[model samples]
Target chain A: MSEPIAGAPNGEPLSSDRPPAPSPEEAIRPDGRWLAQVEAASGVKAGACYGCKKCSNGCPLSFAMDLHPYQVVRYLQLGQMDKLEGSSTVWICASCQTCLTRCPNQVDLPRLMDWLKEELVRRGQAAPEEKVRLFHQLFLKGVAKRGRVFEGELMAGYMLKTGGAFGPEAIKNARLGLTMLKKGRMKLLPERNKDRRWLKALFREPKGGSHA
Target chain B: MPEVSYYPGCSLEATAKDYAESVEGVCEALDIELRELPDWNCCGASAAHSLDHRAALNLGARNLALAAQGPSPLVVPCALCYNRLASARHELLEGDDLVIDEIKALGGGYAGVEVVELNDYLSSPEVTALAKQRATDLDLSGLKAVCYYGCQGQRPPAVTGKADYENPQGLDRLLGALGVTVMDWPFKTDCCGASHSVPRPDLVFTLVAKLYKRALDQGANCIVTGCQMCQANLDMYQEEIAKQMGKQVYLPVLYFTEVMGLALGIDETPKWLKRHLVSPKGLLEKAQLPRQTWERL
Candidate 1:
């Protein structure tokens, strides 16, 4: 495996302004076990990426990412779990499928990012962008309860969980929420799905459930 | 009447209710019967797939299983829901026995049912012809639109099977048939930072601002789309985007179905238009389209 100059947390330069020199001790070494796990979980071979930066070039959210999309694939190829798990890229990726669409190898980077997020939660690691992960969790929790999303409830839960119930952002959202409510765009009541039993069973943890 | 199963997804019921009403009106006028899928659950969208691959598949499969019982093609209006359901179908068709078994265990049968995006379904020759016939008296000549087909509908060509995912022309063709000058622009299939609007409004504002500015640059009066999320993001955030850009960027972002309904002279067209955060009423008035006086309910 080629050594990446390890200065930034993900072994990529912190920014274009500062380029770090290579250090042998800090270089990421390829570990096949993690790579195998990612491939097994995502069903996409990250090793197939030929260092083309097409994924990075096309990603809409790459500008906000610590590591570009191609760099994430490179980390996977090197089995750099710390870099992959630590990335804001995984959280920031909107699953827009831009990278996967332009990828010559059909690398499925978005799917890989999804696996990394699940693995991060599985390992009990806090996502770099805590709110992004929180939003997904709250969204799923609503789905589990009602079998459908209650946007009004979801937003309230999110605000409370993030401790931003009366914060500036929350205030902005609350105003928008009021407008939506007035316009009849927001439902005051949550709609219930008929088969709540099936939904409960589906949300229940493993063993014969859908999660397994 | 040609009948097909419909999946409105969760957004259509609330935030994009306008899209739902417009879709019904347009379909009714076109003589198409939309049989809403029975007891449909959420497709889990990006959240399900992002958190648990199996759960996402199961959620989508459950809906597909229900749709499979009635129709060959399940038409989904929300692009996010469409992507999740179609991705689940793709995985099921890939012959993953584990996934298939889990879906079967969840009482979801895999019958290889087709999941069609609503825009592609509406763009069919028959539907477009019907729309043209219904729109004979409508004058949309003053409306110039840039059809913004946000990412979910046509990306990752492998899953969507859209050969022209990069330069999809379905909305352009449909709008053109309605006599609206569909401006050809490059940002049609771009991402509008969907769902991130909640967690990261800054990102959505930036992306949406770019889309709005590009629409203006292309000489389009408005932006047209099919997905509810796209419409919501593009429509609801224009004020925020304008504030951030420090410019007057008030472009009317519309759902294609609403436009279709307007062309068909559907009575509920004014009601649907009233629901928009950025109203298209002024644009319609400028186009000399007959305006029905509507009092806010």
Candidate 2:
């Protein structure tokens, strides 16, 4: 269930059916109310963070992200949804868990990042990074349909959807495609698992339809 | 001789078919029967989780439920799949009410099945001992390999249960048992930018370039890895990476299974080796191990 109200950067409605955000005064109350919600969702102790930046220091993609691992958590603690949701950090996380595994506080940055991405996708907001988002959409669409990914169909769909179907981009990929074909890596057929309908119903329609 | 329920994941059926074939070949040689998980679906990998957390958990939960029918370790060959499956089990066990509710609703319950990655499953003492015995007549002493653990195998020790995530010893031990030299390199546990290869090949080129350079700097003949994402990215992007650097960077990235299969003296080794982007024929030849048709063709 989703509401038609718009607050996301792309003016898309927030995807979840959760209640409206509390007033600024209620949110910043010193009782740590906002922190509790984050801690509950992420299964991490938000206040336990000493701002040591250990997670940031150890994250492999920190250089590429807008906000480092610790900063995302810090923003979450402060109830800064604007910074948390708008930053490219969430999409760039890669879910590698380097920060989670190496964090002194054992904060689950990867899972938290997943929650953020889920929210972004639900709200139909275009991710700051385009291709990664499109790839995820196409991949899940393939899985939702066939229970598993068909590399040939998936790549072709991706190239077509991205408008690179028959141009320099396709030419560049053709070399790799030929190599894969020769090596038998790219199968021409899609294999359907026995219970395809079950997974198809699960992911539902791809919302935002490849970037609205 | 224990049999395990195997979930080959999507890559193994497609891009990483050699990995699946070699894994089965090696397992057969080790006398470990891999019964395919009946009608298994994709493990949701990074996409499902990114799109919706509950859906991702449910996807993995369904696979675990199928594997639960039999009392065997669930062996997943793809690192991404293994991570997703293991993470789902961990969350279910940790009492994620939503995940547990979804599992129950789907007629799937966690049966305490052990989800193991290929590296962990093959590197167990018994399996390694069996491998050593099987390969007693074969020697790979000349093959200097730097084992790449990549991101999935070592992260969030909670899910991976890897005590030393940074410098995992499983791959090295398995390779060493085959008489191959495991080079000590610094980038063993680094991320190959994971799925970024599909979206941002430019970033992947830089990340892989660093990895290849490290292996090459150590005078390694090739880079061996257990994770599908790591192998695919490094192998698939070698030519592009080499051209970007304007040099002849011909490092053959081999799945550890191929190496193990070779040590076990499997004849299908050449067929598997030929599947690689940057050919490992030269290295296999230089190692003085018995050459397969890969060297000739």
Question: Highest lDDT: which candidate?
Answer: 1
lDDT by residue (B152-193, candidate 2, tens digit) is 877788787778887888889989988898899888889888
Q: Which regions of candidate 1 fall more than 4 Å away from where they truly are?
A: A1-20, A206-212, B96-111, B293-297
The residue-level lDDT of candidate 2 at A10 comes to 79
Which whole-number lDDT from 0 to 100 does residue B263 have in model 1? Answer: 80
Worst 10 residues of 1 chain A by lDDT: A203-212
* Pairs in steric clash, model 2: none
Q: Write the per-residue lDDT of candidate 1 for residues A88-168, one digit (tens) a residue.
A: 999999999999999889898989989888888888787998899989988898898888999999989888987768768
| CA lDDT, candidate 2, residue A147 | 80
How does model 1 fare in lDDT?
Answer: 0.85
Q: At residue B276, give the lDDT of candidate 1.
A: 89
